[model samples]
Target: MGSCKDEDRNEINCLFVHGPIIIGAGPSGLAVAACLQENGVPSLILERSDCIASLWQQKTYDRLKLHLPKQFCQLPFLNFPKNFPKYPTKHQFVSYMESYAKHFSIEPKFKQSVLGAEFDNLTGFWMVKTQDFQYFSRWLIVATGENAEPVIPEIHGIEKFQGPVMHTSVYKSGSEFQKQRVLVVGCGNSGMEVSLDLCRYNASPHMVVRNSVHILPREMFGVSTFSVAMALLKWLPLGLVDKFLLMVANFTLGNTDRLGLRRPKTGPIELKNATGKSPVLDVGALSQIKAGKIKVVEGVKEITKNGAKFMDGQEREFDSIILATGYKSNVPSWLKGENGLYAVGFTRRGLLGTSSDAVKIARDVADQWSMINKIFPDIDTKLLK
Candidate 1:
């Protein structure tokens, strides 16, 4: 209901005087909005893309499924369909996100590409400028998430290689690479799964796993490993939980090092909690590897006309390379000033932490908005007059 043209005609755009303004309409953003709404605080969500969760709809490969089970991935104040599987497919999760938005009745303004934002000391509110509009609010929440941008690491001779190179974000299935020897780089979840997808299609996939990583079965003894580890993490010390995970990994995956699946110097849970690096939640990748369908190699030293040089001083030819390198968190980029701005879903705790933080922030806003107004006193100046 606001226009940049009208704001330009004057000095300020006051048409949007909602409670809090949230950028990005993904699950995290929607969580923040829903939580605030429950507290009777309305929030305006500005999404740059056409639909919510555009990343999942556009970027995720077809063979992808949630590394965690569905019970562990539900948004706050919402639940996945009862009929949904434990570990839902990527498409199923996407559809669940859509239904979550609907159930919460959260309406996010689409295509509102934010150029930048600034806090006005005089008004004690945020002025978020998009390409075509300016939305003002008492608070600004940035929940664009860690994977808002895809990161492709620089490999030597990568540019000179004369074959198709793309990120796993652009990959859908292995059918396109059929009968072609494809190299899947990085040992992250995407890398493992993408290589498996290629194997299923008989694409002859080879993986470049540079370092040791802790891999676990998605389910052990008919129970999700995540459920057990998370329960342990909640009750036990971090160190104890970390060790428990290591033991579980050892028993289940069993000497991944022998298969070139080396363990990182950092323990699995320790690595994930300390930094945001994701560990593999193996569905069928390991079985495919053990079956000799997916071959593993070391890091890429360089690229050639029709091949890649490995760290072991061996060269292997490939038709293409898919970098599943992963993503980086970046909500801070939107803020020209940090005052009155909050970011969630960047803590690397994945969906659970993201959803929890949204609820926490929403409750904080509901409890303290009046205090913030009194301290700043600008709330009176722009009290929806």
Candidate 2:
């Protein structure tokens, strides 16, 4: 296998090929590569960006941090630094990904935007084509996480609004909106965190929570809520776990009825298990909402030149709009093939890279390939005439 350095960020050079081809160069890709190497299976990573973990380095908000504790989010063969906080910041996590790649001797081909992949009947291999070159591999893994594409809702009159509308990808800090009236759309984890960040900067921010959602504290009475969850999930049914969690939340945070916050009729675990929409694990947003630092509003009915019209017949003005709406994933678009393709980042099951999923994936793929390589080796990757 050959190595593609990061200096060629702008140029798409055909420098390397052979072995497994992993896409995205994010945590999932790096983790799979690392584990495959451990199993004596060489792989090459093709990343569209110059650097690894483009989503973390470029897309995430400035003040953003991991919602889960650091211990649960570790990749295979590497652990977070001991000094990292309970919930590591985006910067810290990005640094960890870089170190993981380096430590595993994983050098990904940079600036290789995979146009599409197709199984070449002549070559008997999956040919991954970037802008500059095509590389063949027996296995193709799509590790681009869920946020690969931002899902911007079609707001009525959104085009007519005369404010700086931006997605959470480019949103860095709230200091830029100091004293400005801002409307934050959506109520996911990012939305809640961004609203609180604006409050810290004294921005008059209003959040639009369209539906009921689960809100959890990072800790309950000094015990990590995640730790509690792992303990409960082992013994109870998902519905029972949800009830127990709702009880704990009510006990700790009190009913949020007065704050215009409504708990979903369904429990968080049930919602996650059923719909794949993750629960918002609260860090410090609720206290601020209760203190009148951030105002909560109903969903947007429409948009005006200056502000959004709410479903409750209320219209308010704001200087800017920050969309914290989440992301979408269509793995087949990037890693198309006749067969033998795997997706590792964001699945319907949330983030596979955040847990032991990648370890299991690498192990399974290696086991499967050991048999393949023994018999008709290069049967899939045979060079086309």
Candidate 3:
């Protein structure tokens, strides 16, 4: 990569990357970098945080585990350790990600948050500006993925609530909330898991189920639910697969509506494909709900001083509020893809999608690299110097 000084004497370094400049050092970015390296292409990864997979390293709760089997969650070039369980813990997954990076000799520049990125029409390159440096590259890979930022829903009168209100991103454990009545907003996987964790800590948690959801048993008949679905999908149509899944789920987990968790009219897979909303895979929360340890509540109408008033006109008191509201992609806030800019990990299909996208991106970039090299021999040696 070439470097130059600006005329303003500001000492702001400008770098011209020979290969793609990847943003975010999450699993997606790491996977792309590894694939590119295997394809005999170099890549520069920029991480906003100090460590790789900042979402897993810093934001996630302690008890979080891979919702899918380890095989499905593994990156493009490396596999999870043989000793690891089918569902690896959060720490174990992070460790595996670290090993994957090391195996590929991928060293990312940490704390280089991209302020903005745009395709420079005149230069035919991507101009990515960070807090400290300006990067110009032929290829730009946005691996920041979805869930780059936590989504805190706007609750009416939330400011009026006297209790400590926080998002699940900052939540670590329920041990600190022992014996406290906690109100968890949202009915997604995180919300369910958090409520389960709270119950384990002897904390009374009331989870808000605002909308219809699909909760499936993590496994069925000794096989993963996802695996079963995939196996069925190969032979049956999508609607048939959904019907089969719902049938099995009903038989396995019983009718969740009786417990206040209503099923959506749209099939889980269909809904997911359409909206990127994942069906909740039960890890132990349903049992807690059935046992009456975790109470289910309706949507909040307004946050009161001690708790919240529900949409059903019921009010409840709680010591704290945990917003398991989920996360969203911050891509549109900073990136304007036009020319050679590519985005991976936003497919909402999770790690499987990430791995698939990473390989495609690497191959595409490699093909262009080869074509450019053939057209301009010694281009890297002379121009990149």
Candidate 4:
């Protein structure tokens, strides 16, 4: 392998055609890259953003902390700095990701957006295509993650009334909405957190909650909820496990019944399905709703110039509307092949979605590649990195 040193930075050169190609530079992609590096694999990660973990930098709202504890959320070979808070804020998390990339020396090709990829059965490789470059790889890993595309709920006059309308993914801070009547649509973590942030900034915020959600503290009885989950999952069925979890959450954190929105008639009583699976447990936003800090309303049916009209015959006006709607997964769009391409992080696996999920995806990909590695001995373990 040929290495070039530019400004004391070790730049890796792509020497072989059969090396693995990993897409996306989020947690899952980065985790795979770090593991491959440790194994001396020469894999290349392609990221569209100018920096790694673009979603963490771009999409996360102000005052947002990891719903999961720090021990579970940190990626392999990289831990959050000790000086960091227990549950890292959005900025802190983004900073941790930057350090992770630098520590592993995972110098991803920045701004190299993958336009498309296709599997070539004849060549037994994936023909990877981007805006400026093209390559072929023996194995392709799609870790683009689930939040690449923002899910903007369809509402009448969304495009028509349009006064700086954008999804929660595009929202960076609440300082912009000072003294404005802000209508926060959705009651998920993002919705509640953003609404709370806006309230602190003196923005008259109202959360347009469509339904009820169960809230759980990140930690319970001085133990991480993540640890609690691992122990429980080993013995119980998913349905039974979900029931146990919800029961604990509702009893401890209070229910959302008094707010007009009723809990859905579902098995697990989960949040939205972003990454193939449901959110672990809801963090209580009902407190904010009941305290008159954030007004919870029914769903939005339409929108006018002043503001949005709700499904329950309510017309609420706002200076700005932050759509805490959700996100969409685009991992399938990266694979290039005629055969079955394995996708892991695009959906929920074993309950927890984005919370410490990259590690799980990395392990799954590792298992799949183990078989591939046996057949193709020429492919260096470094390529897996």
Candidate 5:
């Protein structure tokens, strides 16, 4: 609300936020800011990256698309363009994100990497320290979603590999690996899609299936599997819904076990609810696997000079390696929540959950804002600006 130099350090800049200070300018932060604006509550957004939705804009492959239907992925109080496909492309989704920020006037402080945020008991405010400024606010919102940072697991002798090895975050296209023997280490959605893309680019991709996973068709009976599951969940129980889904998957995609992909003991939806592991929605990858265009292999034991050694004692030579190990939240590393601090979008329920959290946080903050104004009528209104 106001800017002043820190008394102890005159060169350091400090600002007090009137409302909540939201971290991350991703979909989660934008949604929360828009909802707060709707409630007549202003917010300050701090982003480490220069643009909104940096993960989608900077870290995704060209072929990436929303795995679920548009409705499931959209933010609060806004709908995806009707012109866009059911599952919008990465570029299209990024464009929509930009439009959402513009429509809500949610301009965040870009490149403001937060060093740490702590609740100050003395002043009854949150002190957020960034690289250039110190921010104080009564409310703090951690909007950094689950995928704030990529998970890079250590592999034995990976540094000794003669070929280029990269994570999915830095991977863009399979054209770079054309005619090369590529080893994809992961069986998640990104891994599946990356392997398929490699096949399309005439690259030989061997996908490693390290663990049991649920593979479901993206669409079943001309309807989105996610939509069907949501509808079924209205009346049927989760266990029953999982059974129906598995039965249909078996009839449609055949047994994945024969292709080295084993089904997990826990049902798909139940497993997702328990652990945040999402079931892979096959997008032509299964067909390629069946046709021998994409080879499915076992877990990697170690990385060799040329390629990798599998846990099953098989050795293969690869020109490149792609790790689709996925991402996780970095909240624990920065903010320590207490007092007025809150966290949204870390529920593992995706965008739909984010929308819900945004609305709830806005309402709570609005109530507090109103009460503070009513009780402390003589307090400086400029301080609460």
Candidate 6:
């Protein structure tokens, strides 16, 4: 519990005699912690926020549901309550995670944000430092996730606009945008869902079409598409699968104007070959598009005092704007490492067994953690079960 002095901090590499430190309290972190505890591996978790799954509580818009089914989404030893709905709501997810924490009795030291982590060449342990606390551990699990920071696109005069600007990460409900002409930027699930939520509140929500995205219904033929996609991806090549997905996306929600905005590009948004490997399925958004509840615009060229200027050279006015853009994974500074540091759940989906993220990372962690416990029998990995 002692703060590391600037000089003593220099000896952090030698001070890391602890077993391991898990960062974040989300599904991945909790899962790893449970597994480690089951095995009796001494570990500690450092979380910046007071509650578990803080990101979940902070980022989602109204009526947001998990894209995956409850059955597939539950973590480690825990199962979603039998009474829970098929696609668990955000609140349901938070509750489930809370239960997981209680069941495991994993107490994450709150308000202790990991600022950076570094691996010492002389010692095998990782020196993790935070704003208030510092610890040393042999292993590091960077489970902070990919969507940790809200992504706001830069536009000319975006800050100069008089209207309020907010990102989807902090969007809880649409009641604030009621009766206001709002622009929902980005065409992903967040963008579409936020736009629809605003519409239900009697707000005129305009969608800014950035690119064409694939949207799938939560249930198809009485089964979740998430299950179906998981099954298919297991056997098919990723490239072929991506191509097939593009076709299906085009068929269900045409290439351009799916959200009233035009997309000249027939393919999915251009993500770096490293970044755009895995494809995320979109649901409800597609139905809303066909319902004519949302209006789409090409792109934003600049922001004006009156409103936004589009790439098509048209200016429109809005009382407020919501950026349903995306988020970036923010690793705590304490865990900064040179090598032998592991980052799970931030992978760009590509060829099978290629990288770690999502369900794949969960499975890998389960396997690797088990293997390590077996090799280091004294580490007390039985808590994982």
Q: Where is model 6 poorest over a 10-residue stretch in terms of lDDT?
A: 349-358
lDDT of 6 by residue, 1-385 (tens): 3334554545332234244577777776777677666555555777888878888877676588876677767776678899998879989989988998999898888887777687767645577777755676667777677766787789788887899999888788889878999988887767877887887888888888766544544554566655665666799865655565556556655654434544333333233344452234555555666676677787898888868999988999999888878877766534455553556555543212122242343444456556766798555322221
Model 3: per-residue Cα lDDT over 1-385, one tens digit each: 3455543556677787888999989999999999999999999999999999999999999999999999999998689999999999999999999999999999999999888998877667788888889988889999998999999999999999998999999999999899999999999999999999999999999999999999999998989999999999999999999999999999989999999999999999999999999999999999999999999998899999988899999998889999999998898888886788888899999999999999999999999998998898666455435
- The runs of at least 3 residues in candidate 2 whose Cα sits more than 4 Å from the true structure, single-residue gaps closed, are 1-16, 330-332, 348-355, 376-385
lDDT of each: 0.84, 0.81, 0.92, 0.69, 0.93, 0.67
Model 4 scores what on Cα lDDT? 0.69
If ranked by lDDT, best first, what sequence of candidates would result?
5, 3, 1, 2, 4, 6
Clashes of each: 1, 1, 0, 19, 1, 30
Model 3: runs farther than 4 Å from truth?
A: 1-11, 378-385
What TM-score, computed on C-alpha atoms, does each candidate reach? 0.92, 0.91, 0.97, 0.82, 0.96, 0.81
Superposed Cα deviation of residue 364, candidate 4 (Å): 8.3
The total number of steric clashes, by the backbone 3 Å criterion, in model 4 comes to 19
> Which ten residues in a row are the worst by lDDT in model 3?
1-10
Cα-based RMSD of the predictions, in order? 2.7, 4.2, 1.7, 6.3, 1.9, 5.4
Per residue, candidate 2 scores C-alpha lDDT tens digits across 220-292 of 6676776787788999887788888888898888887667878888888778877888787887888888888
Give, for candidate 2, the lowest lDDT window spanning 10 residues. Answer: 1-10
Clashing residue pairs in candidate 2 are 124-380
Candidate 6's TM-score: 0.81
lDDT at residue 128 of model 3 (Cα atoms): 88
Off by over 4 Å in 5: 1-10, 377-385
